[model samples]
Target: MIDPLQIDDILASGGALSKYFSSYEERGDQIEMSKLVLQGYEENMAEVIEAGTGIGKSFGYLVPAILHYEETREKTVVATSTITLQKQLVDKDLPTLMKALGKDIPFALLMGRSNYLCLRRYLDNTVSQSIFASDPTSEDGKLATWVRTTEDGILDELQALPRGVLKSDIASDFELCLGQKCPNFSRCFFFKSRKKAESAGIIVTNHHLLFLDAKKRCDNDEDYTEKALLPPYNRLIIDECHNMDKNATSLFTQVFSYYGFLWEYRKLVAVKHGANASNLITLAAGIVKGKENEALDVIKELESAEKIINNLNSILVMSLSGSEQRVDKSNYSFFLSKYSASLIAIKQSLDKITSLLNSIIGKTAFSDEDSYIQQGINSAICTFEGYSSFISEFLNIKEFKDKVYYLTREKNKNREEVQLKISPLEVSDILRESIFEKLDSVICLSATLKVDREFDFFRNQVGLDQREILSGCFESPFDYKKNLLLLIDNGKVLYKNNQESLYFDHAAEKIISAVRASGGGALVLFTSYKMLEYVSSKALSELAGFNILIQNGELSRSQLLKRFRDDKDSVLFATQSFWEGVDIPGDSLRLLILTKLPYPQVNEPLFKSRCEKLESEGESSFMMLSVPSMIMKLKQGLGRLIRSKDDKGVAYILDGRMNRSREYFLSQLPPCNCPDDFLDESLERRIEDFLY
Candidate 1:
């Protein structure tokens, strides 16, 4: 067992940490959290800690984790929600701790298998030309050069390649990976990363990969403790625990995209017409006793199936016409019922295609060449079966009564497509059985884990019963009252009854005034993409002097953020994702604007189902679920301001509903300077003073 005193000594004021980080201060919250984490590890119990920002949460957990592993030779896995935090731990925190401790600790980073390039696939596509015809002087040759010269066959390194080339042609296919039988398995980059992770003292990964690993273990009934993607470890740390529920739900969900099916169909067609097409036909002839008529009939049936699938796709697109808005399952029930005939037609077509593919496979012998064709056929068969099953289940609501089904429209390269998604009503049971029950110890930490100074909502959401797990909340070290100012609009025209245009105009005007008064360095966060676009279009001419960078605009996210930071007098408009995991310290960010309350859209299927479930259980869905969820999001958005003790800024809320929900909102937020007259000249002057 690790000594608690050793961990405490390291996090003390004059301890080893201060030697490397010159600005490090011994924070009480950090020390307390470290001690609790150490106790959790030593006692082999679950811990839920809400370590506020600036507590050095990473170090707080890292110190105990490294010490425990070094002393006991036990492996620990630290999972985070975003790549930014994962990189920070690997690139900054771990190295700093190693220096402070004066010892080398073995650690590795592991991602999903698709992130790495499979050498076998690359070789087959380029050299054997088994999948597609390739030209030596074209993009195929470029990939060959990259494969040879590159030491680590990770796809992220091949950024110079043309778009869609790597994803479509080179990336590893989960269904196609032959594992140990592959000729190039000895030099696989994904396996290398996995082997490193198996032996490393600490494995750092994101929550998605971690949940996926757990999902694999859950799916396999046998003992996966040794064969799981992640090495068997006793202790687990999940940072950004607020996102755990959503990530776990996503892991357990299934999605079928129209574009995805079309992409696969196109690939099948390409292979059928390629140079090797005759070889496959010959094999089919051999299976049918050289009956040329039968062989020709098989090919004809393939073409017929393709046409049927195409027609099915068109029918699906037509069903979604004029239904572009995101609709809850309850609201979409009538529409889907009205189009039951079309949905049933899709199912019938899928079943017909699967039957044809199966017949061809059954007739062919398992020769090497025939097996290659069989693999592709089997994949297509699975795709068709999956589509058929989904449609069947969707049409028969009784079969999926426990699941939340929803539909939404998405755009891919300016072409709109519909997506059908299904998620569990609650992932708590899954988490309880798959994660908490299997691990020896688990620590879940985040800055915004509590609402109204209680963790009951969060605890219930993440499947932690208060009787079983120890929980605590820590306030931030920074003085919010002294350093931050919160402003709420007191206007009478609150966002109500779908008056989006009026709200957008008012929000755009307020944003322009705030940005101008602050002299730029403003970050305006919107709740929806439509609102963001509306405001951006309206505010462009009004704020002509300042540089405005909109999210998903011409520039990428990283590029936009870089430009915003470099240009001091600039405003950035972003939605959803920008709410959290963004760190812009110092004067680069002077003002933060929230155009609306970050509430989950009532039309969203998952949100609607969760709310209904709560209501069924005799709970107030608004206070218990919606209010708490929104408060956490609000905290994340507000956290963008005042990253450090010396940093100062104003967090402005434009939602007029704050007037009625002021108590609930204010109680969850930090210190505020709410002027009686929100639009008065004095308020603008105060903002100017704060920025300058």
Candidate 2:
């Protein structure tokens, strides 16, 4: 298929990249990675590669991808972990690639089904704004204009929904959409994007949507080849592959949030004062007059549902008396026995509500206009059915050799809540069967996919350990040793997870001093909110002269990042989410801090379940799961610094256990400077000296 491996002519000294840029430093690793990708496509198997920063791994895969598409005319779905990367590919990289290629390639970006505006739902909810926003000064007027003119009705284009509208009222939803039976079938934004994507050879999507395609194919095997979620694709490229397992676990995890479960009924029947505050079932009853008896029946069911939900949640909150617990089949049987009466009552209520709605739908099926109402009612039926089904499945856990059952608590202003959940102990086998094996070829590449210079941890975690696959590790071309310096606490912050008072004071003082010396451009990462809050309290008072932002503050992540990035002298203290995907490539981010090593919380139910499984298999769960996992995350934190060749930064690890795991740390990361001694008061001065 067009000689997929013949790439030297395009990537050599006078090749496409060199001619495209006036001062391009060709990276050999990039070419090598491109070859590895091409080999994967040629051989029709999985290829796992760990390419370091500055390797331009995107282009490495893109060049081969374009060649393969040209030869085979087979679609390739590229899945990324973050929306930031998806935007980068579609908005930035693709244009540059197009310019370099001297032509356009057929490509499209598709998000999950719920991201686009459901024209049917939007119109059904807001009639005027959905059609003619003639009052040009109004928000609805603007939205109407957007609705008429926008190519893809993605929520990303709009800043906010109307003041009274819920996202579900306007955006695409799984529970909604009657497919071709709807009046707006041809014009539906999600299906329009899907249809548009069918023409493109390359499609870009995020990990959730990618796995959703897999799950849909698995759950709907009779229609497996029908392009259920994504178009049929022969080859797949997964960037940010290190996050695959985490994302897969989240995708597979089933949860019934107690509050959310209660809110479904509230949305249906709760009436409150204010414009448009009357719930949907109330408004629907008014719209379709003459269904008074059925509407009354719906009301009675909702009242019963609310009481049962409160009792169910009360049972969980009172019985557990802890934040989390791992449950066995016996526990499931216990819960089933405890909640069986309440569960059956709620089911009866939900079933009654569903039946009434279905009856209304049956009577309102005259015209396409009338049918939108029926469709919305149908959607409500699905939601109620889904809620009932999930509760049933959660308590009805049976024969769970591959899954973990658990319960969790969330504290709020009014209620102590619990969430019942079931997560896969390991997503490796699930992913191997559901996604990788189904595809003709797969390329999983990331900057931090390996542990101790080997893909053993990642491969085994993703169920590719025994698969016939090609793997490689490509080091970054940048002079990390020259550009980035790593400083350890030497013994000042004696954090052995004990002597808590001593560790907090010393670590906080060190963090404050470093940020002060840097004059505010620092990202101090912590493993827990408790520590983040403790240090932020100390810093906010001590470092009052500088702009300081803390994680879980009043601002959103994007807002905090904007302030941190735009103001060159702002320090942002954040937790796990900020460790990666932070690309501040300038002098503003010359200092990074990690207060503690990131080890999985041993008490968390999912982590405990996985560790127990590993232990049962006669493996050292801490050595195999904990250490490698910590190292990968450590590498991610370090990679946040020196994102580009021009950027120079210093990172500090303030935990004493870091020295204990020195061997694993040294073997896992790239070559960087780590001066042995910093046990004294000169650490702050050293950071300033290095930066200035």
All predictions: root-mean-square deviation over Cα? 3.9, 3.7
- State the weakest 10-residue window (summed lDDT) of model 1: 125-134
For candidate 2, report its TM-score. 0.90
- Backbone clash tally for model 1? 0
On residues 1-692, what C-alpha lDDT tens digit does candidate 1 reach at each position?
77677865788877787766787678988888898999888888898898878988999999988988888888889999987788789878888788888979899888878778877656544333423224445565566667777765667555355434445556666666666756767998888889999888999998888887887787785333566878888789999999999899988887666666766565444433345544344455455564555545645655665565456556557766543333344456776666567677667766766775566567546655445456666777788798888877777776434688766677776666677777888988777767887887899999988788888888788777633787777778888877787788766556765787887888888888888888888999999888899999877888888888899656656677788889877899999888998888888798999999888777576887788888988999988888888999989999888788888888888887777867767887665565555563455787977566
Where does the lowest 10-residue lDDT sum fall in candidate 2? 364-373
lDDT (C-alpha) at residue 141 in model 2: 81
Model 1 residue 146 CA deviation in Å: 6.9
- For all predicted structures, in order, the TM-scores are 0.89, 0.90
Model 1 / residue 188 / CA error / Å:
1.9
**Which stretches in model 1 have alpha-carbon errors above 4 Å?**
122-161, 164-168, 222-224, 271-337, 359-374, 672-680
